[model samples]
Target chain A: MEEREISKAVIKRLPRYYRYLGELMENGVERISSGELSSRMSVTASQIRQDLNNFGGFGQQGYGYNVKYLYEEIGKILGLDKKHNMIIIGGGNLGQALANYVDFEKRGFYIKGIFDVNPVLKGLSVRGIPIHMLDDLESFIRDEQIQIAALTLPKSKAEEMTALLVKYGIKAIWNFAHIDLDVPSDVLVENVHLSESLMQLSYNITRYEKEHPRS
Target chain B: MEEREISKAVIKRLPRYYRYLGELMENGVERISSGELSSRMSVTASQIRQDLNNFGGFGQQGYGYNVKYLYEEIGKILGLDKKHNMIIIGGGNLGQALANYVDFEKRGFYIKGIFDVNPVLKGLSVRGIPIHMLDDLESFIRDEQIQIAALTLPKSKAEEMTALLVKYGIKAIWNFAHIDLDVPSDVLVENVHLSESLMQLSYNITRYEKEHPRS
Candidate 1:
């Protein structure tokens, strides 16, 4: 498949589409129209068509889209068809949670190792993945060919850890740390700022309260 | 201050702005120009100016923006100045991690209680907050006047729990379940799909590998 530069907006929504389609497939739905899929997704029908068109629209004019085919295709587009070896940088609560998140394994992301600074947690394991100390990180990344590293470390340690990860030739980082990382342009970062999300929710709640003042 | 409808795009950037301003304040930066802030944030100067402009443009023509003032204003806009009481609907690893995350309390969203279906987990405390059984959920929510609920339950229980939460008057939901919840229009839901994030990472890795295929 010829890959053109898809907009970040479209790329962001692909995962949701992939998920909705998977749900449809699980419910035994064979095919669905753009209108139907859009309603299920709460996205506009035209927007769905346009977004799908970016990756060569797989819809038949009269028949709509094949649910199974669309699901598989979108999976391939999201690069979930291949296995990815990843490691968590801090084996704290968040790191352990990510390591134990069964969905990652289901989607082809294998937790090869977990690294933490704490010596007490060094020998511990989460979901059969051993937690290794920061000292062993360099050789482990090289030997295991770790493709991604999740930073669940403190903000103070984030930069140093990022530098170490980048030095060890890590490709992508799923950072949960409070600070924004300074990495090479080649390294992709997807930050999961829980506080930021909480702030957004707070904003929404405030808006709702103001708009619907109690009697 | 009068409130007007702010664009979702601009609202989305507010958190980043808030964080950057916070970092600046911590670094003893009392003021910053749009260009300076833009360089720090990686957002365009014009874009930063425009986004802040939505909240009365807390900037001077040449003197630049008062970082402390802007930070406080953005914090107020995000409703971070107010306290919010919340509960976790599932006491799994993800739920425990969220409970252990101290940043939420600093942001004024307090985790008052954690509810779980598992008898083994019930009565266990995470960071001093006790994990209660599903039976105590209703009374706890009502008694505490809980404003937010974080759903960390499995997909099978997500819908049912959402129904219960809606019935008991949960204002907002931070859903970590794989399912897209069906809640009332008044109830807000922010989904954190771990698999979707991994998929995005996978897509980026694929793009990077394609763009810079190792020799």
Candidate 2:
């Protein structure tokens, strides 16, 4: 299939559209107009039409978009149609929480294993996924053909683990660590900087207060 | 202080600058030229100078920017210098993990309480923060003067909980639920949409594979 480059902003919105469409599918909705989808979401009807038009314009002349078809297509575009083996590089609360999320599995990203430096947690399991010692990381990734690794380790250990993951041939990283990781251009890293989000909230609150002073 | 309008893009970059400058401070780096900082970060030197220039351009003509002073100024701009009282709505693993994270407190975001609909989880403490029943959320918010609420609840309950939270006067929300919330114009919400981030990783990995096909 011939593919054209999609803008980053449009790529960012794909997952959101997939999510809403998934919800609609769950509710047994068969089809939806751009106007209806727009009403359901924050995106404007014209914006929805424009974004979808980038992917060959799914909607018919008057008959709206087929919800399931749109949802599946978006999921495929996101590479969610294929199964991806994943491992958690930390067994801390955050890592375990991610392992227990259960949503990732539904999206075809399976948590094949969990690794940690702590000896005590090595034998434990989260949601039946066994935790392994850091010593086992190399063999496990190789054997499982793990493509994506989630880094939930501390700031002090993030860079070291990142280097190790790269060396072991991991292609993608979902980093929760505070520090940035230096990786090869071919490798992908998506950072979930919780503190940064908090800072954004703080900035918004400050701006709001400045605009609306109490009498 | 005279405050000029800052763009959304600039606001997004503030946290990153804050993080990088913090690392410089920790490494005992006293000052850094824009060129040197550019080499360390992905951003270009001219872009760094332009971004900083938005806030009165702190860099000296020839010397450099004082790392500690720049960090402090960015932190103040991000509103990290002031304390924010926060409550997590949900006593699940995600909520517990957020409560256990010590970094938020260091950045002046305190998780004062955790609330859950599960009676079994009530009275349990995560990092010494007490877990209360959902029924007590209203009183807790009022009594503690809570400024921020973190929603780690399931999507099914997110909207109802958001309504209650808004009614109870939460100024800012860190939403983890897989649903977009409707809030008053004055209220602020920062969504940590993990699925969206994962999809982004998936898309990147797919693009990489397509570009560098194994011979």
Candidate 3:
């Protein structure tokens, strides 16, 4: 299928499908019907079928989908089949927490190093990855062939650091910074605004309470 | 406006509008036309107008929108106007990281305490909020009136802890437990699948590299 034919909304949902399938695979499930999968996911069965059909129909009419095969297929589609060298650009709480997260490595994102401007964090290591000075970022990325840089820096420093990462040939950014970055068209950015999600929770709580007021 | 008239898609976009308007207000911009705001955000002007119209039509024919007023209005709509006491149910790396995060407080979700089954973390504090044993969770929630619970626990423990939180009367759950939760209709669960976002980044990078092959 042509890339242009796929909608951005569909692209966003691909990861979710991949995750649910992964869970099923881990549970030793062999196959799943669209209806069953839809029951587990927030999406509808027809929508699930439509989404899977877009990339060439993986589901058989009656046989459903082979869990392992479908999981592998989605992983390949998401480029999780190959290991990508990544670095955290901040050695603060979020950065440190992400470095210690074992799931990233399990999903083929290898953290080569972490970089921070603070001299106090220079020698610290999280999960065996040393925290290096920001001054060493360029040389480190070059030497390590780092493909992704996770920006957990402050909003004040986000844009400047993003420019530096782009300049140093980083291909993508997983930005946790509170500011929107201005990257070149070629660079891939996935901004993870924590507060936005919290706000969504806030909205949900308010709506739920209003609808189901205590008797 | 009736609550039923507001779609979930519109509810989700409120935070982005709030964030953008907050930025504009910070820049001392008093007002903005939909066209200008649309350029800054990626949304279309018509869609932005429609979304705002869903919530009592904040825009005017010639005046566009008042930036500060719009920001505050969106904030109130998302229930960010009132402070909500919250607790982190795990004192692991992620929980510690979130506890240290100051942005939650700025958004009016106060981290009242952090709880963990591990005794080693019992007395530790992140950003002045002390970590307590899991045994203290019930009493802590009762004493503090924690409206939201952030679950940063492992997938193996998520369901058990979720049941406990529900039993303890948690109104909302900001879940990072890497598992789908089973909550009653009255409870709000916002699942933050970190790996899914990472996979999206991986896919975007792969797609970009494939399309823009190096010369």
What's the residue-level lDDT of A59 in candidate 3? 95
Clashing pairs in 3: none
Instruction: In model 3, state the lDDT of residue B137.
Output: 87
Judged by DockQ cut-offs, the docking class of candidate 2 is: high
State the displacement of the C-alpha of residue B38, model 1, in Å, after optimal TM-score superposition. Answer: 1.2
State iRMS for model 1.
1.1
Error of 1 at A92 (Å): 1.4
Across all models, the iRMS values in order are 1.1, 0.8, 1.2
Q: List chain A TM-scores, every candidate, in order.
A: 0.96, 0.98, 0.94
lDDT (CA) for every model shown? 0.90, 0.92, 0.89
Candidate 2 lDDT over residue span A101-121, tens digit each: 789999999999999888889
Better of 2 and 3 by lDDT: 2
> Taking the tens digit of each residue's C-alpha lDDT, what string does model 3 give over A1-215?
43456777888888888879888988989999999999999789999999988788789999999988888887888899999999999888788888987988988999999999899988989989999998898999999999999999889999999999999999799999987889988888998988899999998887777777889
What is the CAPRI rating of model 1's predicted complex?
A: medium
**TM-score of every prediction relative to native:** 0.97, 0.96, 0.95
| Candidate no. 1 TM-score | 0.97
Candidates arranged by lDDT, highest first: 2, 1, 3
Task: Predict model 1's lDDT versus the native.
Answer: 0.90
